[model samples]
Target: MAEEAGARREEAPEETIEDDDGYVEYVPVKKRRLLEQQKLLQRKGQNSSLVEDGRGAAESKPSLLVKASQLKKDQPEISATEQLVRQEKDMIDRLSERKTLMSVRELAKGITYTNPMQTDWRPPSHVRHMSEAECDEIRKQWHILVEGEEIPPPIKNFKDMRFPDPILRKLKEKSITRPTPIQVQGLPVILSGRDMIGIAFTGSGKTLVFVLPLIMLALQEEQSSSLGGGEGPFGLVVCPSRELARQTFDVVQEFTNVLREKNYPELRSMLCIGGIDMRSQLEVVKKGVHIVVATPGRLKDMLAKKKMNLDRCKYLTLDEADRLIDLGFEEDIREVFDHFKAQRQTLLFSATMPKKIQNFAKSALVKPVVVNVGRAGAANLDVIQEVEYVKQEAKIVYLLECLQKTPPPVLIFCENKSDVDDIHEYLLVKGVGAVAIHGGKDQEEREYAIASFKQGKKDVLVATDIASKGLDFPDIQHVINYDMPAEIENYVHRIGRTGRCGKTGIATSFINKNQSETILLDLKHLLKEARQRIPPVLATLDDPMDNVEEVARASGVKGCAYCGGLGHRIGECPKLEHQKSQAIAGTRRDYFGSGGYGGEI
Candidate 1:
């Protein structure tokens, strides 16, 4: 019976098996019965042997087999279900892992890395850099205008104007053959004792416009003095900078020289500036000088010290009025205005008339006549303006190229004193003769630099805006803007350095991508006012990728093969290889090292 039960448990369907409440039981099956019958027949021979032995062993074995089979069959469904659940869980885990990886990859695509120490990063391009060819073209064009174009004939009908013999002789000696438009228009009002505002370009001969009338008035006053000595500041000409004051004083002295030559008494002129001794100026003041040429600050200082009095000043001239207002001199100018009596004649001259200056004029000048000449501080129609886009790093490179290609005797204007020094040093290293001038320089140093530049001892002058107005260097053939001026009028002053006295000259401005749009707009407006034809390329919008690297690649030039160490080629280099090598190895070691190690170690 046990054997039958064991066979039935092994063959039975797994789902029908169960545990008993009181006793374990197995249901009989037809297959199990057949198996039992066969086993019985096969064991018939062994049965007789088993009968002799105990049946206990066989029965025990069958019971054990039945129990083991029942246990395994009971657990089969649970084991299979657990395996299926584990497989499903594993599949979900793998899918989640795959999604995580995709997310990480997507995040990585948008990220970037930056290294602050990397020198390879490109700088924004500067707007003041220009190409050599472009600079030359501009120079050529301006020279043509300066030489070929006839300035509009001076306004006629001033022959009957009354003036002192000394003043007339000086005017005739300087070939004041005909009066300029400003002179023609402004002289009448100035002579009529009416205040006026004169707007003109730098080289439009505006200085003479007021100077001529002031001198005539001073002479008339001197002649009328019964005591043979004029008193109480007969004429006062105030300028923005000490250099401008000195310049005006020099011009006025020229007129005085002509006066003395004609047997007229010397016109006493006092120069009041910061660097010169104030005591000396006070001494001149005590002696009662007829005319005073001074800067605003020094003039104010003198007035405050009570060392000088302007209570009776009849004629007052403010040159570079626009610059004064721009430089925050409004308060100082107003204070100076307060010192003068209301009946005084005030003449205001500026290259441009911005709103601030116009407002200042309204308060300063009484019913002033406004005279605008040569487009009113625009690029002198005589001056040719050309701009080149270049990388700031390559600015020096382009400047050297321009200097090489064009003529010498150039004036280079920088934005600051440090820039002037840097450019001056750079030019010297390149074997280019140059000098630098700035406010930091002492009067003697400044005077020497200007003298050197004017005397042709230096081929290039790198200077701050201090050298912009009134300071004239006659032979300057080119003006290269190492940096753009802050104001449009400053640009006019800088370019005005060249192309003076009816001589054609060139002004080369460097423009880079990083330049301020406000400055560019001002430049555009200035160009339009001058009636210059704008280049189509400059008129177009700049590219976003207009960076320093692109500009450098466009403007950079490899060292000339012929010149070796020099910027020019070997054939063009004035020095031989041995001399060039020695110079580069010794005097220019720092410059070459800055570029990178150049010589063989």
Candidate 2:
């Protein structure tokens, strides 16, 4: 029975043991081995879970690193873009400021006095005013023949003149008629030992104005042997440019030919300019000459080298006085003037007078007469003025168009040397005949270019303001300002190149939006002072003529008491019919006709 019970228990599924209520437990025969197996299974499961968790953590860490790196890289790009945007804004602001300053400068250009005809104006109290009757009486007196009223006819035989016999003979040979107006007016004053100021337009016989006086002085010095037996120069004529000095010397030489023929010849002159041999000039100075016509820079050098002496200079003339100052030669001019004896007779001749020039005269001139023959501080009336508003980029294109429209032999003025060459090259590329002259070129090149231009080898001469004044290019049909001058007075000089010797011509200025308001104002004032009608397109909102009706209402336009004309004031109206009739008939016939009609009988 015991064996049967044990078998049953063993067979009872190796019966599970109950540790707690209703719980079953199993036991293995190799107890150590079983426990080891169970422990190994549990450790394997736990290791699996740990490995999965570690993989997730590693993957998350890599993603986080990538995101942080991306953020770091993006930060700099954003900052750089911001910096670039700020820089662009700053540049824009600077450009705006420059534009504003330029605008103000243009507005202040050339303002002058208003015309009396256009407005009710009065002369300064110090100035004398004359009535119509008084002016008419003076005109009549000018025509009357008083004792010795007639200029004695020039001596048929030049030998009878007081000049050296040879010079007189030469004058007779050349058939030089009477002295030109400038020569007549300027020579006597200079010879009388008085400081003089000559105001004449270009080619209005101006060369003769100073040249004749210089020649006479030279002649007197030669006759009296006042040169101290050496070639020490007796007179010094300073011009602004080398080309101008050469031109003046050439004219003087021509005049000297006549003097030479009359036996008062042997006049010697030296030319000192740049792009020439300084040693050769020094040699000439050492040899001594009666006259020296030079430019400022070269003259200054020669003076420094002791190659020229001005302490004994008896005559000093500043030709083209306005140009000398305009070119920034004021200091050089002052230095030259200082070198001369204070007692020397100085002549300052200019086409226009500005405040700077007036101040210069006050400092340099000694109580001189201001001889303004034609319109003062204005362009020559004979020059037909025209202006075209164009874009800066299109200037070259427009210049070419203008050249095609106008006749050849045009003088075009630029503001810069590079512009001269640039336009010159552009014209050449367009198969146009053109030449350029500027400060950058050598003296010989300039001379050759000018000569070519003068000889008609080139149809157009492209030059800077350097060629604006003191240049005599006869037969120039037009003067085109490719670049308007910075100053209004420069415009006057530039236009003066045309309308020379009473020959009418055209002056065209190209105006751009960038042009200064000062320049425009000055141009307007200049036109007004010259009695010219300003073009409506150029008229600004402030122009009196723009609101003529308004201005007329404010001023109360009235008819003249003399002629009942709307354009004239009560006291002022030209008697056109009477003046026209009197002008048509010679003065003698007009006087007789007016007086002989219905005699006292």
- Native-to-model Cα distance after best TM-score fit, residue 335 in candidate 1, in Å: 1.9
Local distance difference test scores for all models: 0.65, 0.64
| Model 1 CA RMSD to the hidden true structure, in angstroms | 28.8
TM-score of each: 0.62, 0.62
What tens digits encode model 1's per-residue C-alpha lDDT throughout 377-480? 56666677877877999998788887864677888898889888988898899899998899999988887888788788988889899989866776777888
Once fitted onto the true fold, the runs of candidate 2 whose alpha carbons sit more than 4 angstroms away are 1-184, 226-230, 531-533, 544-601
Query: For residues 353-419, what per-residue lDDT tens digits would candidate 2 score against the true structure?
Result: 5433544454444445444455334577788888888889999998888876567799999998888
Q: Per model, how many backbone clashes are there?
A: 12, 21
Report the Cα RMSD per candidate.
28.8, 28.3
- Misplaced by over 4 Å in model 1 are 1-158, 226-231, 528-537, 542-601
